[model samples]
Target: MTSRCILQTALLVYFSTTVLAVNYDLLRFQLSSSSVECQNLLLQLNGTTKDCIKDRMNFKFPEEIEKPQQVQKEALLLVTLDIFQKTSDIFRKNLSSTGWNEIIVNNLLEKIHWQIEHLEEILEKIKEEENFTWDDRTLLPLKRYYLRIVRYLKAKVYSICAWKIVRAEMLRSFFFLDKFTNYLPN
Candidate 1:
């Protein structure tokens, strides 16, 4: 009876860990594919904007995020979560300003919002398993990048051309995220 109890306990632990890992991987895959779809949608919308603005914006993805291999998995995940949250904010704020098709833009926002929620879930699970603190400074670059975009939008008076450039920059971000998903541990 004692041996049977031990066996059952061990099996329970094994299955729980396996299920958690699978959930992480599955969430990563879902977020990756969603990012790709968002990228394509952004591309299509950007193409619709007339190329009348000659001014170029210098905003871009943070270097650390661009090179996912160099950063630790936990930190990468945190940064990604932060970026996604910020991206959702941008989408919410500029939903009507893009001057693009409202339905498609809302669809993209919904997808990103979903990705953000799932990422938070995965991160919370990992945090429970591994106790580690991420530095606030790690997010400085992202904050700076986001600030640049905000400034650009304000400078351009949220014009259609300005939103077009912002959309193009966001496309680059989603492209990097899709590639970064492959780096996540399965």
Candidate 2:
């Protein structure tokens, strides 16, 4: 009876430990997902500006920015900030062109800045729930919330690009009309 009880107790301990084991895969997945999300956001923004301004502006997104895997595990925040800085620099350079209107450029910058902030917040949320299992009911809400934030950023970028194109067309028309008027007999 004593041996049987000891075996049962040992099995119980083992099962409990397994049940409480940390899921490192989930943590790594979160990190990877966040990194990709950030990269996608920057790339989309780059594409938007490029499409809006076309050959009227010269710009390129930095394609070699470091990924999350390259970041030191202990310095996640610092590396993440570095990533944002590089992307932000690209954005500023693109918008500072003399061709783009100041008001539209400022609006674009503000949208990107807020998007970056939101991305950082999402990363924090992921980190806080690193130990959660994939099947956890809590994870569903978390993923849904994060997806909504991503969609919001994407929509804002699209809107800014659309507006830029329209504004550019209006300015061009005004300039052309002004030139035509100048050529008229007066």
Winner by lDDT: 1
In angstroms, give how far residue 56 of model 2 lies from its true place: 18
Which sections of candidate 1 miss by over 4 Å?
Answer: 22-24, 46-50, 95-97
* Residue-by-residue lDDT tens digits, candidate 2, 1-186: 999999999999999766654343553454344444443333333333356554232122111111323323433432333334433443454343234445544554564466467546644654554542222332233234324433433444535554344334323322322222222111
Q: How close is candidate 1 to the true structure, as a TM-score?
A: 0.89
**Candidate 2: lDDT over CA atoms?**
0.40
Candidate 2, after superposition: displacement of residue 60 in Å?
18
Which predicted model would earn the best TM-score? 1
Please provide, for model 1 over 1-186, each residue's C-alpha lDDT reduced to its tens digit, 9 standing for 90 to 100.
999999999999999887776365776778788888888777667454457458566786688888889877667777777777877777766546666787788888888888788877877777777666677787889888988888888888887778877887888888888888777775
